[model samples]
Target chain A: MKLREIKEILNAEVIVGEDKLDIEVKTAFGADLMSDVLAFAKAGSMLLTGLTNTQVVRIANVLDIAAIILVRGKKPPAEAIALAKDVHIPILTTKYILFETAGRLFAKGIVGCLEKVEAGSERI
Target chain B: MKLREVKDILEASVVVGEEKLDMEVSTAFGADLMSDVLAFAKAGSILLTGLTNAQIIKTAADRSIAAIIIVRGKEPSTEAIEMARELQIPILSTKYILFETAGILYSKGIVGCLKKVDGDFYK
Candidate 1:
């Protein structure tokens, strides 16, 4: 689905890369843990998360993510916003909580990047 | 829904609270961030998260959450398991990632504790 449709569906506000709403994203990964994103997230998929740290933008850049969707009405810190702008990554903020955010997108045909999670989780 | 049904649907294993699998929970909150779980999560709701630590048990206890659904096949620290056993709160470990866990639960009529998010989000 195009980022434009996701925006409308979630009532999300584009905090960055407003011009890139036309970008199409077929998969999504949701997590508040940055480590999980680094480990399991695939390239070009949208990241749905509650984390607003600058590292989020940096990681998205490293992974070639399509966009960052912030749930539970979260807004980025100024430094994170600056970093995202510098990297040209799109960021959208939505009022839905994490569960609803994932459910809404999944209901619209957006799927998780990985169908099956890896066998085990490491200590943080 | 009953905790037994949830465990079956998510293919979750009972890490704690085996005797309480019949506990009924009607709502859920998904997050990996503990702060959000503390702030927005309601009492008696199931918490779906990718975090597994002693702090998770403490937070769930403070919030009176009905259960902890640990996603991504994450295992809690030994300290956390002990705490949950002491607190008598159920913990279910699922292999599904956070997104699929929430989507599946939401699809099954387990709704988010907070229906409409509050106007502004804090940093």
Candidate 2:
């Protein structure tokens, strides 16, 4: 699905990268733990996170994430938004809590990048 | 709903607080971020999270959470289990991803303790 559709479904406000809303994403990884995200999130998957810090923007850039969806109505600080714009990473904020955000996206055919965690952080 | 009912719905295991399965919980707050959980989680609500560290137990204890539901098939660290035992907080493990877990629980009438975050973490 395109990021544009996701913005509509979640009633989110685009904080950055509005020009790139046409980006297509089929998989998503949700976590507030940045280490878990770095370890497990696959490239190009939409990252659903509760953290609104600049670290999120940096990590998304490193992982080549399609976009960052802030859950629970959390908005990134100004510095984070600035970094995202510089990195060309899109950020969207939604009022939906992390659970509902994931549930809604899953209902729309978006699935987890991985269903379960295996030992050693390896996809077994 | 009772913790037992949640277990049945999510096919979860009672890793701790097994004897307390009858405990009723109608609200939940899901997040892997400890700070967010601490800031927003209300007392007596189930905590749905992807994190399994001992910090989770400590945070839940400080906030007086009803139970901790470890989603995405993640198990609490042994330290977390021990702490939960000492704190008397129930810990449940489920194979469903966080999203699926929330969907099922919401379908069964467990709603978010706080639907959205207001400014300055006021709500």
For every candidate, what is the interface RMSD in angstroms?
1.2, 2.2
- How is the predicted docking of candidate 1 categorized under the CAPRI scheme? medium
Query: What lDDT score is found at residue B37 in candidate 2?
Result: 88
Q: How many clashes does the backbone of model 2 have?
A: 0
Stretches of candidate 1 above 4 Å error? A120-124, B120-123
Q: Estimated TM-score per prediction? A: 0.94, 0.87
lDDT of 1: 0.89
Flag clash pairs in model 1: none
Measured by lDDT, the strongest candidate is: 1
**Which candidate leads the pack in TM-score?**
1
Q: What lDDT is obtained when candidate 2 is compared to the true structure?
A: 0.87
TM-score attained by model 1: 0.94
